[model samples]
Target: MAHHRTFDLLSRLPKVDLHLHLDGSVKPETLLELALHQGIDLPVYDREGLIPHMRVGEECGSLIEYLSKFHFTTRIMQSGEALERIAYEVVQQSAEHNCKYVEVRFAPQLHRNNGLTVEETIHHVVEGMKRGQRDFGVRGGVIAICMRNHSCQSNLEVIEAAAQFVGKGVVAVDLAGDEAAYPPEFFREVFAESTRLGIPVTIHAGEAAGAVNVYEAVTNLGAVRIGHGVRLKENRSILEMVKERRIPLEMCPISNIQTKAVSSWEAYPIREYLEQGLLVTINTDNPSVSGTDITNEYRVLSDRFGFTAPELVKLIMNGVDAAFLDEADKLLLRREMENEISSLGVSL
Candidate 1:
């Protein structure tokens, strides 16, 4: 059995985060400051107005409504300076949470409404991320996300932009957005292009949709990692396929509950996935919106599901193994984690 204090200490352990959204993790205070700098009036400024919108309560009826809150966030991230600042702040915050490595994803198409070219959009974010790494001493990378609802041709352009940034900090390509209407098959060509270029792919599936989406994402879209694959619980066969293939599921418990994918933390399928031998990695899809962090997510799993320290170490190892980093980097990170755990005198 894992001691509670050990679990609390594990929360402080440096781990790799494989599924965090750079835009979604914006700090509320930073958002307010950015809004003020841009002279934009946001309805929720302080913690009082922000807490209600952040928590998972009766007010958030569905995933769609919960996601609608991004409108306020996107409003302030219109300029190059704003994007750079937010990106830096995101990496800094991740480091504060003891995240040694992170691959932050964001849809460049969403930032184009403010007159920034797609290439320039990626450039600004990459610049910010590089700066964050230099200043914070936390290594980070960018995953370009194409919105699912957009046209396939538009997504190809996003992929092309990402391809151009290859070897320049853009590590992977992902498909994200409303999953209900836009099926995974719609962007097969874009994913094919990513595969052809040897770029890894992750798709948002089994969240708003069901197991069918997960199947299509793997079979048709070539998603090596499935984002928010909570709906895998709906189909046993698909879950087996995931386990057999060793495909990673980036599970976000608080985000799922906030989006009504699950009713509460106790109802989450994380333990089930772990017990079944599926490659599961914990994440905070949107820390600000979900009002949680990597530590809080780990704490919830510990308190609610009785996850032992060894089990928690397995979960962290899963993330480090499943990350998009190169072989050398992965080996270094693995050794670092092992050394830290060994120093703590916790036997696995």
Candidate 2:
């Protein structure tokens, strides 16, 4: 049996985060500052007053309610400077937590209401992420989001913008937004274009909907990864298929509990899925929105599910395996992680 590891050791462990949202992870203080700087209106002017409206955990009623917070965040993230700052802050935070590599994602179209084109949004975001990499020495990548609730025409623009930055820094494309109302079928053609452009795909599914949505995302949209796939455990056949295919599931415990996707941390299927030999990678779907971070996420898995140091190592390895990085980069990351662990007197 595996024994639990101390939080201090976990904190020192090198990590990979593949499913963080930029719009959802902006710091409260930063949000307030941006609102004032951008001349954007906000119901609250200070961090203490704004945190309640921004951080939604168990109080979050549903996915829609959790997502509603984006309205305030997106308002401040419209300009190039705002986007750059948020991107830099996200990577900086990840670096502080010992995350060696991270993939930050957001829908470019959401920022276009302020007169920025989708391309401009992607450019600024990539620039910011690059700046963070230089400053923190923590490598980062961008994943342009194609919102499901938006029209195919709108998603097409996002896909085109993503294609323009494939090797530059945009590593992959993803589908996000209301999962139940807008199925993967709606974005099939857009994902196809992304595939043709050699961009890997991940889709938000099985969170607000059923396992069939997960199936559709994999079969129709070519999603190599699934976000918030908490519901996939409900169907054994689908679970078995996912296991057989080695499809990685980006499971966010606190976010799921806050969104009411799962009842609580104890009820989350993370341990069960791991026991069943599924490739489950822990993540923070929306850190600020859920009032959590990568370290807190690992702590939850340890306290709630009894994930020991070895199991935690496996979880991080799962993220490394699922990253959208190139083969050479992946190999280099693996070596670095191994060396980091050896220096800390730990082993896989």
Candidate 3:
């Protein structure tokens, strides 16, 4: 009964997802159906069989192994329609969970293996998200990702394609992939191009690597937010830098646990960071990949960390503040969210 009430309250709260990946959030059922429709070959023939292979187990070895799951999902997402369906479903799912805004990201270079142009890939995803917004009232934005493992030239090409959609539907540009293998310093010039065009930047850092990576992401790549920045807790200087600059850490607790990003749930740093008055936001870094959602993320925070309605409200509002929306949109969201949350017995 308590769990049900908690879920009901959580569903009623307005939310924002800052670090969702399009290719990483495809549903298992949808994956099987899409595979059949596209005539793509799969190792497993059924959803149950495919799920165990797709979703990483609780003891995922390393960040590289954790990311390899995308190979299967991205292979099937090369077609324009597949990209559209994935983006559309992402928005629909976010809306169903009461997420008022979201920033969905994907690496265009990953989808071009099947011969589709990068612009076409971005166009299809934006089209699907726009359709979802029109139907479900969930405001959506895209973030073009440049993989760390890919060639610099290819990443530059992705930047050019992403810059074209700066104000159209794409919200920001991001760097993703094996952070430990490819440092943020390598993409210095690429991120400079994004900065020159006034495009916001976010980087996947302090997850597979260390605080040095987080430092480079902000100092070199000009990142406004850090994705899965759970490791930022280890270094005091990095923590101070984040707090001083007010850089938001997009924290995905379950995903971190599954990837062994942190040793255990007891050692999670989000609550500690919050207690220190740092800017932090809760996110489902990869819903389907992590087999979790924004609501479940909140439930874990509540049940495991003893977060109350007020504390949960603060985290949700952090997402609002950290969103890639413009000032006017942010103001509108703040007012709307405040009204809704306060009515639900959340105090400010």
Candidate 4:
């Protein structure tokens, strides 16, 4: 396909993003503005410093260093008002990128440094999402994230807060943050509780860790989706299980390359996972942090992995199917996305 044609087609294709972090999506300009307003000093305040950190370059040598960039963004988002504004901006940015629906995840515990209770943190983000939906006509849901390194009790508390907001825009629970330090087995009870409440669960596994993390997430934590599950390719048994179970892997190629999860886009296991019949969906895990969007991700896949228009469409459908929303909403969004793709004259 011609590059411009592919770009145009991808831009017009209605899509759903299943994996995106709220704090990680803060735009550099927005971060600078927020920092100035709050009088917070950051090393990378100028465009020169900010641009390098935003892109998937030498700055992100490892997942830990990649995450350190968020410290600058999250430092300014200490209040409920800041969280709400950033959430609204996240949804608005998604809509601008032609996303029809998005599941935005965030670790609320990280926001409590300003003495804001967990409930209050959820309230701020949920309110922002609601406002964005009402204003931009893009449907969204919040996934409450529990950091892995935290104690099991802390994870349970986050899950309890998520349970409280079940029908109120908080649709799911997730395990994230520093995969190497904490394993998925540590949060078995939390995942069980989330499953018992009928809330969907996903875990950040196989990104910085090994395939064992992915296996534990599925068998031990009951994860329906695996975040950055590129490592699952190393273990055939786990790969087979993921394929048989039809678990979705939210593959963020740019973020993976930036965080050293994989060497390059061509080396990414997204094609391997797709060929093995594991439901794989493309996403920009953190657009601002990775200096990418859905369009850029699609372009990278198409260019490096030789994904055709139909293949990209299938990826979008996979995301819609794997979303945490209700069946009725999924059916509705699927139909709408298909219609949009059809309008682009792309054969699927």
Candidate 5:
């Protein structure tokens, strides 16, 4: 039998987070400060009082209710200064938790309500990620997300604007929002442009919907990775299609459970997927909103699923393989993770 490790050891290990959301991950104190700076009226003025409004947990009713937290967060992320600060702090926090790499994602369209263009919005996030990397030594990238509820024309404009910074700062594009309502077929033209530009693709599916959505995201939208694909097990054929394609599934344990994406903790399916030889990578979907960090995510697996050191390391490697980076960077990151573990006097 495999023995679980302590939280301290888990915290020290190098980590990779690929599905993190920028708006939902902002610090409560920072959100309050931004609210005050912008003179935006928040329901609460203090961080403590504001947390209940911004953060959520397992008791949250459904994915829709959990997503409601972003309504307040987007209000504060309207300005370039606020966006830069939030993006920088995301990587800074990643370093504090020993995350070697992360991909911070957000809908550029959501930040444009304050009169900024989509290009300007992406620029601020890229600038912040650059500064964070220079200072914290954490390598990361920005992902531009298009909302499902938005018009196809509107989403196309966002995708075209983001393509300008693909390699410069933005690494990939993603789809988010009410998956059940919009479905993957709705974004065909929007993601078609992404494919034409040779940009990597990932989509939010199988969380609030069924496995068919995941199938469409892959078969239609060219999603190289599926975010919160926790519900893909609903269809064996579609699940096998994912496996046969070698497409990785980005799983966020805390967020999935909190959103009721699964029936219960036992049905989360991380172990089940692993047993079947599917590629699974752990991520922090929305740290502050979910009230979780990458460390706590691993702790949950350790406590509930008995993921030993080797199993944990396998997940890390899976993240590396699934990253949007080129082969050279991915190889280098894998080596650094291994060397760092050795230096800590721990063997994988």
Candidate 6:
């Protein structure tokens, strides 16, 4: 234990991130390039100047405020070329940080503010991700997202578009944004359509809303996974349901604090959830926006929760289990991580 630097070991370990946001994952340099190519005027051109606009700090009061940061990045992603390039960069960055698998989520309607159709938007992302896997050996796909704030009819269209790409490069469908104002109750028909289309469902619930939203997501929306289920802890019955059903919770500690999902790091429920038998996976909700990555997440969490080698392996495996990969692929990924960790000389 003394011989190994925990960060080094964690960095080399294979990882999975199921909650990352494609719109929020744009590289600062890439943002500048897209802005330049599109003639979009930004307040800053350099990385130092551009990064602050992309990220939120303690001043970020609520989920909606934190979401305001995406205006810069998402505005730049209107073109298919820009989306493809950003997708490629996401894979390259994930691979560089040793992520074996990842699922980048984005609302297709965001890109459609320009002339791009939803299908075209997904096609470009798929092509970019395919190219990344071809060159970088990191395999992953996209989760098409339905924004909660949209009209119900519009959300149904988004899910319909997502359903078309289910086997192509898209893995699942997720509901994101302003969950407090737009509860899962209103989106039942939208996700019901997803389940009917054979697309797996994950919802952003109990995030800006209460545990009741989490309950509605599970019972009404047919959500197989809950994104940022922090507030679920507020309701014992709902918490027990999540634990009893073994629904994976995508817990992002950094973004949770930045969005005030929890009051502080000490208040975050990762350790408590794990101890209480809730299946939990650590993820970077947005790498660029949160200014963190998979390795950095594992390390910071280790510092706060006192996670050792075996516990760290549990965290990584939790990600593998919760990943959208098929069973055989999950087995292969598990073996790859185990072999890599073993070769790194860290006993797990």
| Candidate lDDT (C-alpha), each | 0.84, 0.89, 0.89, 0.86, 0.91, 0.88
Model 3, 1-348: lDDT tens digits are 998988899988888898899988998888999999989898888888888767887878877788989988998998999999989999999998899998899999989878999899999999999999999999979999998888888988888898899889999999998887888899999999888888899998988788888999998889999987888888999889989999999888888898778888998888899999888899998888888899889988999998989899999999999999999999998998899888888798
Residue-wise lDDT of candidate 6 within 1-348, one digit each (tens)?
A: 752577677888888888999988999999998899899999988989988899887678989888998888888899999999999989999999999888988888889878999889989998899999998998897998998888888788878888888878899999998887888899888888898998999999888878999999999999999998999889999999999888999988889888888888888888888889898998999998888988889988888889878888888888888888889988998889889878877676
> For each candidate, what TM-score against the reference?
0.94, 0.97, 0.97, 0.95, 0.97, 0.97
Candidate 5 per-residue C-alpha lDDT over 1-348 given as tens digits, one digit per residue, 9 for 90 to 100? 223337777899899999999998899999988888888998878879988898886689998898999998998999999999999999999999999999999999899888999999999999999999999999998999999999888898888988999789899999999877888998899999999998899999999999999999999999999998998898999999999999999999999998899989989899999888889999999999999999989988989998887788888879989999999999999999999877866776
Q: Which lDDT tens digits does candidate 1 get at residues 1-348?
A: 446676558667777788888778887778878888889887677856765554445457788887787777888888888888888988898888888888888888888877998888888888888899998877888999998778888888889899989889898999988888888888888899998888889999998888989999998888999998998989999989988989999998778877877776766888889999999999989887777888888887887888887898899999998988889998998888788778777664
Clashing pairs in 4: none
Please estimate how well model 2 matches the true structure, expressed as its whole-model Cα lDDT.
0.89
RMSD (Cα, Å) of model 2: 1.9
Ranking by lDDT: 5, 3, 2, 6, 4, 1
lDDT tens readout by residue for model 4, 66-163: 88777767788889999999999998998988999988999888898879988899999999999999999889999999987787788788888888
- Locate the minimum summed-lDDT window of 10 residues in model 6: 1-10
Off by over 4 Å in 1: 1-4, 44-59
Report the lDDT of model 6 for residue 307. Answer: 85
Candidate 1 vs 2: which has more lDDT: 2
Clashes of 5: 0
lDDT of 2 by residue, 1-348 (tens): 223447788788999898999999999999988888878888878888998888885667999999998897898888999999999999999998999999999999999888999999999999999999999988879999998888889998999889999999998899998887888787889898888888888999999998988998898898889997899988889888889999999998889888888887767888899999989998898888888889889988888877777889999999999888889999999999989977877778
Candidate 4 vs candidate 5, TM-score winner: 5
lDDT of 2 at 320: 92
Best by lDDT: 5
Q: Which pairs in model 2 have colliding backbones? A: none
Model 6, residue 268: C-alpha shift (Å): 1.0
RMSD to true structure for each model, in Å: 2.0, 1.9, 1.2, 1.7, 1.7, 1.4
List ranges where model 6 is wrong by over 4 Å: 1-4
- TM-score of candidate 2 to 2 decimals: 0.97
